[model samples]
Target: MVALRGRVWDSGVMQNGALSELFGRMADVMEILAEDRFRVNTYRKVARIIADTPVDIGELLESGRLAEVPGIGKSSLAKIEQFVHTGRIEAHEALLRRIPAGLLELLRIPSMGPKSVKAVYEALGVTGMADLKAALESGAVAELPGFGRKKTDQLLKGIAFLEKATGRIRLDQAAEAAQIVGAFLAEIGQVKAIVPAGSLRRRCETIGDVDILVTVDEADVPRDEGRRTMDERRGAAGMGTGRMPVLRAGETLATHKGRTPSAQEAVIEAFTAAPFVDEVLASGPTKGSARIRTVEALVQVDVRVVAAGSFGAACQYFTGSKAHNVALRELAVKAGLKLNEYGLFDGEKPVAAAEEADIYKALGLDYIDPRLREDRGEIEAARNHTLPAPVSLKDIRGDLHMHTTASDGEDAIEEMAQAARRLGYRFICITDHSQSSAIANGLSARRLARQVKAIRTLNEKSRDLTILAGVELDILADGRLDFDDAVLADLDYVTASIHSGMAGDREKLTTRMLKAMDSRYVNCISHPTGRLINERGAMDLDMEQVVRHAARTHTALEVNANPWRLDLKDTHCRMAVEAGAMLAIGTDAHSAAGLTLMAYGVDTAARGWATKKDLLNGMTVRQLQVFVNKKR
Candidate 1:
């Protein structure tokens, strides 16, 4: 029987199967060649369909159903069958030979794609990391088609970081590091203002590293002798004595010392001399900016000195989006002037001095606020600017929503109140989770009373900040508050929210929300939609009806500042503002650091064009108390 059995199918059939595999591989090769993502995706789609078809592709071809598969047309099918018959694809092989294999890897670079990589490789013979490094070292990369030294340095640094730690560090982690550095600098007494800028300031989902810029007093510069002594004695005994001598008023030192050194000069020198800096990018006698390459990302620190009056303007100019600044420059150009990181200029000459207000005046516009400086029609609005007076961080007198150990917060009531007082806030409400959500250690009725009593005890000790006992009561499926009116009436503020049954029908959800709004003690709705960004969908609700009801009842809507849940998103905020419903921006901080998230919320509010009048929290401490008392 074995002898009788002979190969029924010829080698052509095997070749046909091999040709299909080759076509699939060729499609991938062509995709990488063209860098046309949409077309590449289409080919990948066809390949996947052919691979996953129920019937054998060979049999399907025999049955003349190859084109019947989705994403596969007659042309594609012909190519597939041809590849199956032939050992190679002539065109694909030719492209493979022409394109350096290393160029394909460059496409993975962030902020750069295939087109840019191809351009770079063709112009500079830079096909991969090895070639790129050699070219950069030889100054060849900088001399390439569109790249300068800045771009070359950036590319090299980026490649190094990518090869080391490729993924972005968590935003919270980056903030933690910035906070540590900020606290250290703040303790130096001479430091006036220290701020974290760049991607962190923009509140990106992830950050590469942290950037902190500090302003110091001009009178704090160390004398040359003092610096030399400190440098020489750094590892020797009496180093501490050297530091003390710099501060001492010795007659010998006074007579010999030159004119007092500039504080700005000293700061510049200190930063350049720091061991943390890998290289000094630029420096000036009185002002300088340098980029420090850290394991995470490049940290750019710029230092400048101006009259105290002009400090705010400098800060605004330095902290910017290039696009936003470019738009400002274009506006200046149209008005027969120029704009730069320093200030507005009249044809390369300083016109309005270093004052931001003067610059705005020179542009024939009301001072375009820095918070609204995202180039989102801000320039146009400035020309005919009827910009709504924005709500400032100072105007926020109270935070109505917060958590404590009763739920997930790390700080106790007293600790949080002290932190809030340091920030000049007038009042804060402790709104812990209600009983339904046991996972968060939701408070039972007895525990709520105990927590309220604790808040009262802390309130008596709180010197400037008022403490409001509140509860973030969870709304049940039937639209009932977690606590009854008796318990709710005992609290200063109540923020009702939906945490479960998110997938409920629209009518049920709307009814649930409406019933909670009817409660006399409920002051606002917290994160109405219950979305967690890319995770869950927002609960269905009749938003128009909900807005109307909130307006009718004088209930406020909360714009939660939690990064993961920027609920009451810009669109919803605009609608709420139009509906005459006041908005509350709360950081929902679990720790002291979380309070800083208020800036993000404020940015979001600005994007929605919310004015001070539209924000319930944008009031003085006394005014906030009056509002709460009136509600009571």
Candidate 2:
């Protein structure tokens, strides 16, 4: 029976293109073998591409073309072909049997790696946490080479702490913390500028700590005006105009006049010494920092001060992906100089000390935008000088799709419109959910008409922004649109999307989406694949075909900004952009706070290398109005 079940599963996987299943099995095997994280990640990435690929995996394997896929090279292609030919992956199976399965879970503990897991297993016969703790109490862990009493205690504490604490906090959490600290620092008269740096600035999925850089002038300093007169004079002269002077050295003097030389020092002191901080580290007058344990995660806070003129460049340098900074350094080397947190130098001589943009310009490239500096082909792109024009928050003139009180949204038409106008948006389309989404107060014809009337009234009263009545019409089970053509046409902008009956045959899903796209009044498609991050999987559909249809029909696809969704993700956005499909970055905002999520949508768009030309919101107010009129 087991053999028969295995055969059935293999046949089904072969038929449906379960490349991820095979690759995931292989990754599990690699984990058992204690393979490096990067190698494991490569296999996983390759698996994802294969699972998402439209073509049959068997056909690709037979064609000897698997290496053509990104992140999959000769080594991976061989493994894939081996799995395709023989139902067994030998290396993975061997590793699986040799390594205890439970050890894989142990590796997930913070600061614990495969080597440590293996060590515990071998030394104490501890394959799980319960056994490991017994070994720790028995002093077996301390007896191991390099595992001293101190290290053992820390590991035990880490195990206990991580068991109760969340493993990693997302980047958004760090951003929130930074905003709080920034507001506090802003109130200080000495602070000239404060900007977040480090992984938080790079928008990494998780951050180790928060680094805030600040600039300040001597006049802004509060106390000890006369005693430290020489230090102030040096700060003024060495700081250079517009640049915050980096203090070489200073002494602690309590004059009570608020004579802080470095803004970074001030911010570091303020946050580290705050009531929220559970522990303080190395508090000094010049460069004190600390770690604060919040309910969500532990945040390491650091502050650095530089001359005012170089603050922007310094912030950019410090907030870098080390790999990106290294690439920039190499570029500087080729130009006969060195680059650092301060600024660029020519043969140990300060040549140009201005902003980050100026530094990039001096490197003989168009200013490399900070957001694009993720070290992923950006260096080559910069060298080839092919970087797209940086898309700004200002380039967005309106949100093409949003929700309101008519649906799940907290705000009414007038309130949402007023909020949009306050944020400098010229227009907003209220796209309430169709009747299928009854939970969101999905609108029927009569309710939709009432909402339209309210929007029209708001438009009449508002001079700065226009409010367009819209509907997020659902794609029903029968591959047909939720609302009839008559109802769709009554609205100013129509965004048709799939809500229910998400899982289905790929061809059926594709047909359903195509049918919606074919509608004359359908202006855009929301979320496109209906994926919720780390939760529900995307609906099975031909994404390339969907993008092509959207382009042909002049229907835009939305990159939903809600954190949980960022759907029509970066890769899909790039594909849609390449297909000439106009893309819209919408908050799909259910509340006024949701509007601010436009940045996340924009980030996803930029990650996809999208430029203003590729976005529907990039259009001028007049152009967008004309487009809406055309849809009508």
Measured by lDDT, the strongest candidate is 2
lDDT of 2 by residue, 1-632 (tens): 01221111111112112345457655655765667888878877776566545345768777867667678788877666655543234455566577676665565454566567767777678887777777888898899977879878867765675465344455455665565455444545455666677876655445677887767665556533322332343253332112222223453344423454444454444544444344666564445466653323356677665677777578768878888899888988888898887778887777566576778778877766666677877778776889887566778988877888778876667667767876788888889899988977899988888888887887787888888788899888886787888877678788888887786999999998898888788889999988754334578889999999999988999988776677788778879988998888888977664576687788778867789888878887678757766655
Candidate 2 lDDT for residue 292: 57
lDDT value, residue 33 of candidate 2:
61
Candidate 2 C-alpha RMSD relative to the actual structure: 21.9
Clashing residue pairs found in predicted model 1: 19-83, 19-84, 20-84
Model 1 residue 459 CA deviation (Å) reads 6.8
Instruction: Write model 1 residue lDDT over 1-632, tens digit each, in one string.
Output: 01111101111112222233344554555654665677666665665555434334656777877867778877677666544332123445566577776765564454455556756666777778778777778897677667788887767765665566435553444554454234333433345565555555554435555555555554553434324432443333212222211122343556635544345544455545443344566655445455553222345544454444445445556556557677767778888886765666676667764455787788787876555666766677787977667666666777778888778886677767777776678888899899998988999999999998988888777688889899899999899889998998888788899988888899989989988988888888999888654334478888888888888887888888775567777667768887988888888877554565675577567656688888877876566556556655
Query: How do all models score by TM-score?
Result: 0.53, 0.62
| TM-score: model 1 vs. ground truth | 0.53
